[model samples]
Target: MNENENISVLFKIVVVLIIVGAIFGTFMSIVNFALIRSISNEISTLNNLTISSMNDRMNRMDSDISSLESNIQPGGIVDEYINAYNFLSNTNLDLEKLLTFASETPDATYLTVYIAGRSNVWITVTNNGQSLLQADLKPGLSDYVFFISGNPNVKTSYTIMLAPSSIITTSDASATYILLAQNGKTSILHTKSPSLSVSNILK
Candidate 1:
C-alpha cells in the first residue's frame, strides 16, 4: 500500500475509537442518573408510609381515651383505668401491688385523682367492686398525665404521675386507688365501664 493511503486509514481508525469511548461514557452517565432518581423516589414513598402509620395509631388511641372517659364514675374504679390503659397501650400493666402503695403518695400532681359520690367505683369482676381512682371526680372531667421525668420516651425513664385528693370527701381525707402490678411493674388503671366487682363478672 502507498504510505499516504496507510496514513489516512490510521487517522480514520483513531477517530472511530474516540467516538466509541464518548458514546459509552454518555450511556453510563444516563444509567447512573436514572438509578439515583429511582432510589430517591423509593425513600420518599417509605417516609410517607411511615407517617401514615403513625397517624393511624394516634387516632386509635384518641378514640379509646374518649370511651374510657364516658365511663368514669363520681368516685372512679381503679382497676378499670388500668384495663383501659392496657387496652390502649397494648401493654400488660399491673396496678395491683401499686394500688397497695398508692396511699403512700398524697396530694401529688396526677398523683391525686378524684371522682364524686361513689361515681368512680366500678366492678372488676362479677361482684368485686373498687373505686376507679378517686372520689369527687366530676363527670366529663378530663385528666392530663404530664411527664415528670422529661423522658417518657426512654423505656427506663417514663415515671408515671399520681394525683392527690384522689377520692376526696372520704372520711379520712384519704383516697383509694386500684394499683395494678404487671410483670413486676405497678400502675394506676382507668376504665370507661369497668366492672364494679369480680362478682359483676359475666361468668
Candidate 2:
C-alpha cells in the first residue's frame, strides 16, 4: 500500500479508539449517578423511620406522665382524709377493748404498756387497795416489768389498771400493750386512732 493510504488507515483507527473511550466514560458516569441517587434515597428513608420512632416514644412518655399526675391528685386513688379516719377508729376500738379486759381479769398484773407518740401518760397498779408500782412512759416507747404475787407459795389475786388519760385523736398513729401472767400466759393489745375530721368525712 502507498504511504497516504497507510496514513488514512491509522487516522481511522485513532478516531474509532476516541469514540469508544467517550462512550465508556459516559456509561461509567451514568452508573455512578444512579448509585448515588439510590444511596441518597435509602438515607432519606432511614432518617424518616428514625424520626417516626422518636415521636412515638415521646407520645408514650407524655401519656405515662399524665396518668401518674392523675393518680396523685385530690380524690384520686389515695385519699389522705379517709386513711386518717380509719386509723383513728381502729386504734380507739383496740384500746377500749384492752382497757376493759385488763380491768375485769382476775389476778391481773400490769406488765407493760405502750403509748404511741405520747410521753405524758403513765400507769398505776393496785392490789388489795395498796399501790404496787407507778411507771412513767415516753412517747413512742415500750417498757415491761416482772410481777410476783403477794404470796410466793400461792397465786394471789391482784388488780391492774391505767390512770384516766386523754385519748389520741390523731391519725396514722398506734400504741401496743403487753401483759404477762405468772403462769406464762401472755396478752398483747394495740390501739390506733385516725384524725377526727378525716374519719367524719369518710362517713
Best by TM-score: 2
Candidate 2 Cα deviation (angstroms), residue 129: 47
Question: In model 1, which regions exceed 4 Å deviation?
Answer: 62-203
TM-score (all chains, Cα) for each model: 0.34, 0.40
lDDT of 1 by residue, 64-108 (tens): 887677657443465456444433342223234224334332332
Q: Which ten residues in a row have the lowest lDDT in candidate 1?
A: 121-130
Residue 174 deviation, candidate 1, in Å? 11
Quote the lDDT for 105 in model 1. Answer: 29
